[model samples]
Target: MHETNVGQPESNDDSDGIDQAWLQRRTAAAPLILGVVAIVTSVLMLGMLFGALGMRAGIDLWRAGNRRWSVILGVALSFVGVVVSVMCAVLWGSVLASVLLSRDVLRETERWRGQRVAAVECSMLSADGVRVSSLHPAPPMDRLVIVFVSSGIDACGQALQDLAAVAPDHPTCSVLLVDRDNSAATTRAFALLHGADFPVLASETLLPEPLGSVAALPTLVVLNRDGVVECAVVGAHPRSELHTILSGAQPVVATEPKETQGP
Candidate 1:
């Protein structure tokens, strides 16, 4: 009878050992499995959904004190998932904004094309209210190119350069750079850097009500010989398009030397 009782204790010890082994296996695999799931979901662009699951698994493994490397990898994958999700969101937002802006610009262009626009009899003023006629020509040109710009914007400077290059091509088209907000010094600096041949004017208000309000910087407006608005582009346009528009108008053969030139 004593021998039988000792044998029973041995069998119970074996059962306990088996149970412990099973528990350890489960604990070791948990974080690894969860980490793989998180990584896959992140690659699929699921954002934070599976990331939370992986993070929870990693935390659980850390508490269990098993599979340290698995926990580390799982946490790292979860972090990557979160970052990818954020980047995807920003990319989507930019795409949506671009689509909407394009639609609005197309509609505006169609509405203003071929319509007669009133001449803006506005005078250009210096920062100190000094009248600058060179920046604002005294009418009589075949076509007028008015570009509204804000200082320190690279896109605006590029637009100015493009217009300046093409302005000389079409003698009839006079290019004017209108400053939205900037000191005379800043404007001069930009003009110098870009080698602008057109006049730079400082104005608080947008000229010619027909062109509507200046909602965006670097708005380009083309006026015909009769003071009619030919086109108004809200953003920077390709040089080819600008040239096409200028080419449609009659070129003035003579060059009038009244205003600003490249320094």
Candidate 2:
């Protein structure tokens, strides 16, 4: 048998070198383009100011002159300069605003992508005040779970109503009600109204930090079994979006990553 190298490419060094060179060139060019823009904006503003000054001087000179042509020229130049200066200032302001907005958008994107949260260890307390943490380090699966945290009477009552309305059809689906109040009255009400099926967790802690800010009075977080946040909403949602999220089809609004910027 002839000696041969199996699955060997002839040469990648040349192509690799080309790719590196191209990347370097592109990186270098980006700053140069920004610098050029700044310089151009500055030059245009200066030009506009000078034009206005020349126009004013011409007007003065023409007024002092015995001839009509000198006066006309000076007045025309002054008008031209003023108009150009206004346009330049407006354009510069607009460009500056856009640059700032883009930077903000990019920073937000990087913040979300860079942030990683550890998987959650879920615990639940029944209306009877029983604690259940039996499953520590629960296997991170792909199923969807909604956490409804309530503080006041209205929220707790509403959650019970909603869960009762939604849970039977979603047996695999878990609804964790984190009640901070934990009052006997609240506990009794919870058990009587909504405690028959899904698990309920009570907490003295006010809120879940990792979820960040919420918009509406009632908040809903749809998390994957892995504990990574899949979708989140602050207020009530349309029946359609809610159903889709429960079905693992649509992502919650807050989970949609914000716009990003490029260097």
Candidate 3:
């Protein structure tokens, strides 16, 4: 008589041989499927979902000492897939935000081009010793540039530092840092840290409209001597561009919400 039962078949999971349960459930192929699926989903920019599942599967396979070339490939590809997914997600999100903002809120903001914004009180700035101007110190300024900033956004903070860097190439315009979302003490410290010679304004109570209601960060509101807005630029601009914009006649065209590319 010929015997059918002989030896245990090889298993990628177990170093010695396949287990009894492994015979019932095809657990060996599960990791490979998950890892491959994760990669596919990541490519679709749904990496947050399948990428995680694939990564977990990969980790399990690695920990179990799966030495098969297919499983190893799955493990490696899963990691790569996760990274691609994250990068794609961020890129897509930024593009969407920029497009939507340009269509909606930014379009509405454009309407305020010729409207005169009120001069904010000097009490908005955290000055301990120096006498504060009752209103914006606009009497001596030919142009007033109101820069709305947020403490949360790194670009806004960098905008303050950039303004400081360009302080040497001073403009006839006076730059005012209006805190859209910032604490008085932190705003004061932030300005001082960046060596901002210009006026930095914040209020414990919400300031008036346009200034208080502004949604975009690092937005520059350029005004003439009459407090009427000549132009408004929304984006993170470098010191050189900022100097030119501040020093020039008027900025009618606004830059797209993205990192400025230098000529």
Evaluated against the true structure, the overall lDDT of model 2 is 0.50
Task: List, residue by residue over 150-180, the lDDT tens digit for candidate 1.
Answer: 8789889888777777777787667766776
lDDT of 3 by residue, 135-242 (tens): 333666666777877666778778888877876675566776777566666666776776765556645544554555676777887777666666767767877787
lDDT (CA) per prediction: 0.66, 0.50, 0.66
Output the number of the TM-score-best candidate: 1
- Deviating ranges (above 4 Å) for candidate 3: 1-41, 45-99, 119-121, 124-137, 251-263
The root-mean-square deviation over C-alpha atoms between each candidate and the true structure, in angstroms, is: 9.6, 25.1, 10.3
Better of 1 and 2 by lDDT: 1
Candidate 2: count the clashes. 2
Q: What is the lDDT of residue 74 in candidate 3?
A: 63
TM-score of each: 0.71, 0.41, 0.58
